[model samples]
Target: MKNTLIESFVFLFERELDKLEAEIKQYPDEASVWKLEGDIKNPGGNLCLHLCGNLQQYIGEQLGHSGYQRNRPLEFSARDVSRAQLLNEIQKTKLVVSATLRKLDDESIRQMYPEEVLGYPMTTVFFLTHLLAHLGYHLGQINYHRRLIGR
Candidate 1:
């Protein structure tokens, strides 16, 4: 189960990250990635930041010890970041996630996850599953944002 789980996780994470990069690239221009329109709470650029921050903090730093320090506030508040930079972040995040997951094994994944995300301990696999869902939810948001803002 662990081998299958890890393989599945790596594949899905890569796929979603690829989609994320594509969504960001879909914007007509760099400025368009930061465009906020009616009823839109977060622009595409911020979503990219938030997604990369989440993955790097949880999977890269916590699970994989990548030493990434995430600034949660800046993920949302920073503005006008170039699309090139955002795309680069996505690519880096993909590498981190892939490397981290590849290093895990059945025994390690079965142990309690290092962080108590829900105020109680859960297995590492459970937390990783949750992370995938989180990524998907925001990926959908980025998709809708691009469409809504006519980018």
Candidate 2:
């Protein structure tokens, strides 16, 4: 079960990251990636940065011990990041997430996460599930932002 579960996670992460890359690349222009629509605070570029930082921080640094240092503020504050750079970051994040998850064994997946991310203790698998959901949420937002921007 654990092996299958881990494989599923790896596949999902790879697939979603690919989707994210597509979303950013599909933006009309570099400016469109950072354009803010009415009532919306975060743009597509920042969302991509946030997702990269998030997975790198939690999975890469904490689980995989890749020693990643996250600049949480920069993820949202910085703007106009080139699509090329964003795509590179996305690919890097994909590698980190995939490698980290692949290393997990059955016992490791059920163990408590290295940090109390949600203001409470949770199993590694649960936290990973949450991370996947979070990624999807922002990916959806980016998809919408891409379509709605440049209007």
Candidate 3:
């Protein structure tokens, strides 16, 4: 039963990745890729950077890596990136995450992560849930941005 749950998460992550890829491809132009908006006062990260950074952080933290040295302020401060470049980044990140998930045995999933690994106290299962939820939220943001651009 536990193994079934883990497999579900892995499968769900792949589905979300595919959804994000489709979202990017649906955009009318490269500039549309960076069209997500939020101001300093509003305090929301743009879809492109948010998705990439969040995925990087989650995958890195899970796989026992630093997860892209996340600086949220810098992520929001950056300029628009090209569509091709953004798509390539998305693909690369998804591959890394997928590969990491592929390596997990049942024993690995049941293992407890150090507090430092999570940057807070959380069981491995909880940490995985957090990533899944976070990614789903950002995917929604991306889709919202896509609608704003009429794509």
Best by TM-score: 2
- Using all chains and alpha carbons, the TM-scores for the candidates as numbered come to 0.95, 0.96, 0.78
**Minimal lDDT window, size 10, model 3:** 36-45
lDDT, model 3, position 16: 86
TM-score for candidate 1, residues paired by index: 0.95
Question: Candidate 1, residue 22: CA error in Å?
Answer: 0.5
Residue ranges of candidate 1 with Cα displaced over 4 Å? 1-3
Each model's backbone clash number: 0, 0, 0
The sequence of per-residue lDDT tens digits that candidate 3 reaches over residues 81-133 is: 66677678678777777677677766676666555555666666677787788
lDDT of 2 at 90: 99
Cα deviation in Å at residue 26, candidate 1?
A: 0.5
Which structure is stronger by TM-score: 2 or 3? 2
Model 2 alpha-carbon miss at residue 134, Å: 0.2
Query: Which residue pairs overlap in candidate 1's backbone?
Result: none
Candidates ranked, most accurate by TM-score first: 2, 1, 3
Predicted structure 3, TM vs. truth: 0.78
* Regions of model 3 farther than 4 Å from truth: 1-3, 36-45, 61-68, 116-120
List lDDT for all candidates, in order. Answer: 0.92, 0.93, 0.68
lDDT of 3: 0.68
